[model samples]
Target: MLKLKYYLSLIVWNLFVNTLGKSMFTPQSIRFLLYKMAGMRTASANIRSGCSFRGKNLVIEQGVFLNHNVFIDSWEKVLIQENTAIAFDVLICTSSHKIGGPFKRVGDSDRKPIVIGQGCWIGARATILPGVTIGDGCIIAAGSVVNKDCKAHTLYAGVPAKEIRPLENREVNANIK
Candidate 1:
């Protein structure tokens, strides 16, 4: 029965989500429903088309807005809290192998969960690596590659995502979603 359920989910995703539902013309509500059938655990999110999650371990809370072409590797848990604005072309990955033998280069890091706190704004084209916990009200700059935990109410930028500054006026990001 469990196996059957998995197969059914695949059918739903492949037929609905992986089809015209991927079109930018397709409404987010319909796409969200289809993704639910495929086992994603989003309660109330506005997810645009072209967002890809290979695994079903994604948890998107209310008021979360995922922009276009967002790619998530949800092999582990990905908890995106309420009012988080994930901008276009963001890549949230949860998988990376630990450093292994010389023959395999895939084993260089550990696969871990990614947690994005509430009222956060992930800028366009940012690549969030595995095990990153972005704190509440944080803003990641565009084209930044986040490889570590981001402090609350902070602004992060650059290749490895250094903390640029503390966001003293938290009200600024409240309207991001």
Candidate 2:
């Protein structure tokens, strides 16, 4: 009965709040309230309309912004720290199927935490896979696939997201304030 109620409410939220574009006009406080009701741990974050998140293991810190159409599949914990901005159409997933085993044959899956440190920017259409820890002040370029841990104050781009360069202290500090 509890599972049924939870799923029903989640469906209602998707239909009324996420798909109906309510966040575009709804006050930020109301939006945060709705998300909190849906079991997300959110601070003073701004989540734009058309964004969708699943599970109760999601945390959005103060000043975090999730742009339009962002999808978070939080099978495990997903933590977005303060002052981070995730651009449109980004996908952050914390679950994936196992490979080459009996469990894989039976469609078994694994989950891990995704932690995005403070003051980072995840560009549009970037995909963050399970168990990825993105350090503070990093920039992930658009269309990148991040499958591993990232360093602090770095710029990462391309498929599978190679480190482009270490961001200068000036560049890193500029967006912090």
Candidate 3:
């Protein structure tokens, strides 16, 4: 089937990238070039080592940056809008089990589209689940598991993350010590 082939190709490509491309890049430019060849939009972006993109329809828009150990289980279309930043160890997954099925299966689950809006920041080790739409300018805290839609200009934290507060300053000091 078409889906089967797609999955197979993804596996093969991931293996090749992990095995060969992992050790060959010293600078971010080299990694960006490799990502371009592998069907990622990497202009002004840094998708770090150990990152995984499993779906053919994974769309990383302009200025999107994914840091180290990022894992995207995008069986369907996972769209990271322009200027979004996914920090280290972040996992955005777009697949989930069909609980109504007679027997449980891994890939037999229904797939959903994950949309991370522009200028959003997903912190380290955060997990964005299937069917979640993160609004523009939203900030997901580190180690959080987001299972619902997050509003724009809001800061969300905790497991099954709830809204913590609104982003008052629009300026996250990246250089804060």
For residues 50-160, what per-residue lDDT tens digits would candidate 1 score against the true structure? 877767688999999988899988889999999999999999999988777778766765679999999999999999999999999999999999999999999999999
110-160, model 3: which lDDT tens digit per residue? Answer: 788899999999999999999999999999999999999999989999998
Would you estimate the TM-scores of all the predictions?
0.86, 0.84, 0.80
Tens digit of per-residue lDDT, candidate 2, span 1-177: 999998897787676556543457776677777766655678854888778777668888999999888999887999999999999999999998776666446456889999999999999999999999999999999999999999999999999999999987565346775
lDDT of 1: 0.87
Candidate 2 achieves a global lDDT of 0.86
Clashes of each: 2, 0, 0
In model 2, where is the ten-residue run with the lowest total lDDT? 14-23
Ranking by lDDT: 1, 2, 3
Which has the better TM-score: candidate 2, or candidate 3? 2
Q: Please state the error at residue 89 of candidate 3 in Å.
A: 1.0
Q: What residue runs in model 3 are displaced by over 4 Å at the alpha carbon?
A: 1-12, 22-26, 100-107, 169-177
Give the runs in model 1 whose Cα sits over 4 Å from its true position.
1-8, 169-177
